[model samples]
Target: MPRTERPRAPARAWFTGPGFAPAPDPAADPAGPRLVCFGYAGGTPSVFRDWADGVGPGVTVVPVLLPGRGLRSEEAPYTEMAELARDATEALVAAGHAAPGARHVFFGHSMGALLAYEVACALRDRGLSGPRHLFVSGSRAPHLYGGPDGQDLGDDALRQLVRDLGALRPDDRVGSAYLERRLPVLRADLALCARYRWRPRRPLGCPMTAFSADRDPIALPAQVEAWRAYTAASLLHRRVRGGHFFLHGPARLPLLRELRAELTRTAEEREPSWTH
Candidate 1:
């Protein structure tokens, strides 16, 4: 008798739904450059609430919303770096955010920085156009990615770890109802980072800007500077004053100012000129 072939499983749909929110400005220019943002572990899109208007006009701020948070709170959160990166890349393509000739920049903090880097790599591997500029904040280079084993700790211990890292205010109780509610999500996010293993690839072609905070224990200046090796294009390392969560405090204004300046330059470069 001839051998029979077995049925194959259906391909997984990586593009589940829209992965990002619209620009904050209702009247934002459709043709303007986009500033795509991704936040830290267990963070919601609200982290970038003020960025839309803060970056000024001519740029649209689009925040990437991860699962298990905000409106996506019902969805199961991703706990693997590769799977999340693949899904995010598919979502961006389906949403037309990564279309050829589209001008956009990627900004991510902490765990978000790793996601942004992986997504950018995925796009390149698929022969898709990647971000015009890559902005990684409060994260080490992909190869050097490792953190405290917070994911393995108990609920109480994990809560205390985050609080000590400045994720919670000094006065905020570790057992607060709000923190308790987000604890699981935070654990899963931390696990995603812990399990990541870096693979070598060609350096990214787009320019990169890395931000390091003076008081950030997690991502030191040396670690942030290591990002230079991952990009063939120019790398600009900006050392700012504050802790790991500086983007949320008084230091945010100056950071935004610098970001605005860069975005303005990018917009001007992309503008079509008419020669008379």
Candidate 2:
């Protein structure tokens, strides 16, 4: 019989797991607050790749890379929001950013918003420090996840749904092919979101900001406003001008300004010497 050899794993696999994947810019300042970000369904950390420059150098934008995508493509995707949140919390600890006095913020988009909220809760439940602020974009309230959605659509319907959400275009052959390869992961994430049961817990102490598109079907103005109930502190809702994927291109500047301003406020509060 011919000898069979197992393929070797990628060199960076060790650092590319859930929550700990490398951000576009890995620069660190022990005193600077960390902005941990989560992407939409089936999204990679690349969603926030260009955000670091826009956010300025005072805050470190850490775009989380979930499993079963990007560098961890070989790994299985998570099917539950709680499990994902727990893993995110552990990943932060493993990365040494969860230490005492560490200032951190969280930002999540669409399905990522739900994951970020749960993660903040998980951190608080564990007696660990939580983010100073939570920014949720393009998602409804967590408790409203029980709404009916087509998580088991046929191939054509699924593709149509993807197209409707602006993830696919009529003329982008390569992009279409890439989305086809990612459909399974996308379906799993959608199923998880549809089936999520929001467990009632004490509202988080951290303030929250919800960003919604002026006309997003997935998340209407009322749905986004409902997120205020999850936070005991102040909750600000901002309406941007675009559809569901508004944060993708030039439409992202307004949200960036909010992130930068809030981060600057936190920095100045912590250390008055922090330059504006």
Candidate 3:
């Protein structure tokens, strides 16, 4: 899909479609980077909806609402990683072209981080220009070794994992509706996670920044560090307070500040190559 293609919108797109809504002049914000922030399996664009404003101008954060959530409620969530990546790449191209000249970035958390990484590489393979920086939060490296088999996870096991990871609990009072909607999405997301198999490949050339929690059980430092094997891009990792979803926690300010600095550096590095 082109940047101008309408995203399968949940609501009758007042603007046209998901990715093309409120199209901006990608050229005007040459330094004004266009971010396609993906969410964890069950997550939504609302997670980083204000990320652009918070990160400051010159950077426009566009949280990607994967199908089955937000406005595209009718669509089913993508199961295959490559398939999701293709859809994401198309959406990104749409975002970039619809916006022109806007530098691009891919940001994802957990499963989303994985999605972002895969999509970034896919864009690279397709010879399409991609983000200046790859900001991955709360995830393990693709090449990192070891883990229990996540694929055989039954609903009993799946639900336990979610709650154990503190993502959700069906029994937890309140937010049941929220939990009801998100948990299935999370389960489907985990299915992708469990089935994902990484083969040895060349590392991505873009600079990579990873965010982790001091208490993150799913992604430990070693796993996070393993990301180095897959990235020719300089790898930097930051550990903050919070279990899994630290991005929403208090550490966001310092985190956002660092993100701003890196994004600025990346844009400047690419600036000289620009014709306009």
Candidate 4:
């Protein structure tokens, strides 16, 4: 006999504040792990638009939308790392993303890696639930984050730096009016990085995974490995191919697969086993 399709689970309605874009239907797996992703400087939630499918149905993908971009474009962008972290923490809490017993994880790239770490600290300070695992990609550990100081560079110089970092392709360089409009936001983000200062704090309790790209000059493998200092739990460092923005290319699939496996393992460990 032909089998009948099972009924779909009802979606859980959750608040997604200004700091985040809504996740896909939570009903897909209401109790599954949630993967909160933060993108690089001048990046938007759209960068992770296809991530839900990448991570599979067992995990919900939530991409953060920082102010001064996307729908929040009219709002002033934050220029201080601490302030952004505090506000991001509050936004996550308000949306139930940081509720006690919630199973969630975090993934961030470059500037976003720093932001994600700060947010995790903020949550812990408030006595809230932190991520099950913290994934940082293409960034130096917080204490060692000195920079090229692009915030003060002239528009031409700043654009050149972005190009040098492979953030801007050669073909997209000529006559791109959109790039000109985004420079301010990019500068503001750089200012956040330049002005950041890491203070001594207790190491976080969650395990961490640091992903470094072989060709990424800014965040070398050694710098990525330094993330071990921030977490008391185990640190797994994975090296992949491509440049700083490796997540945007061929490397992204394998990265997502690793994330899916990790998230699934964490969820299984959290579940209570039944004794026969």
Model 3 C-alpha lDDT per residue in residues 1-276, reported as the tens digit of each score: 664433453222212333433445644645465666778767766767567667786665666667777666666766567677777667666545323344666778888888888887877788877667788888898755224435457656656666667664335633456766766676667667766777767888877778888888988877777776767757778778887877767887777887777656654565443222
Residue-wise lDDT of candidate 2 within 17-110, one digit each (tens)? 4444343234555657678888998777777777777888766667777777887788777777777777777777666555567777899999
What TM-score would every model get versus the actual structure? 0.85, 0.86, 0.81, 0.86
Instruction: Residues 1-276, candidate 1: write the lDDT tens digits.
Output: 994432221112221224345322346454467887878997777778778678897676778877787656676788889888887887777666776776778999999999999999999999998998899999999998655548889987888887878887556687897788788899999999988889989999988889999999989999999999999877888899999998877778877886776677744553332110
lDDT per residue as tens, model 4, 1-276: 994432321112222344333543445444468898888997777778788788887566777777777656776788889877877877777666666776789999999999999999999988899997899999989998756568899988888877777776446672377677678889999899989989999999988889999999889999999999999877888999999888877889889998887777744553332110
lDDT of 1: 0.79
Q: State, as a TM-score between 0 and 1, how close model 3 is to the true structure.
A: 0.81
* Positional deviation of residue 170's Cα in model 4 after best superposition, in angstroms: 8.1
Q: Relative to the unseen true structure, what is the C-alpha lDDT of residue 123 in candidate 3, on a scale of 0 to 100?
A: 77
| Displacement of the residue 108 alpha carbon in candidate 2, Å | 0.2
Q: Which run of 10 residues does model 3 get worst, by summed lDDT?
A: 9-18
| Candidate that beats the other on lDDT, 3 or 4, i.e. the better one | 4
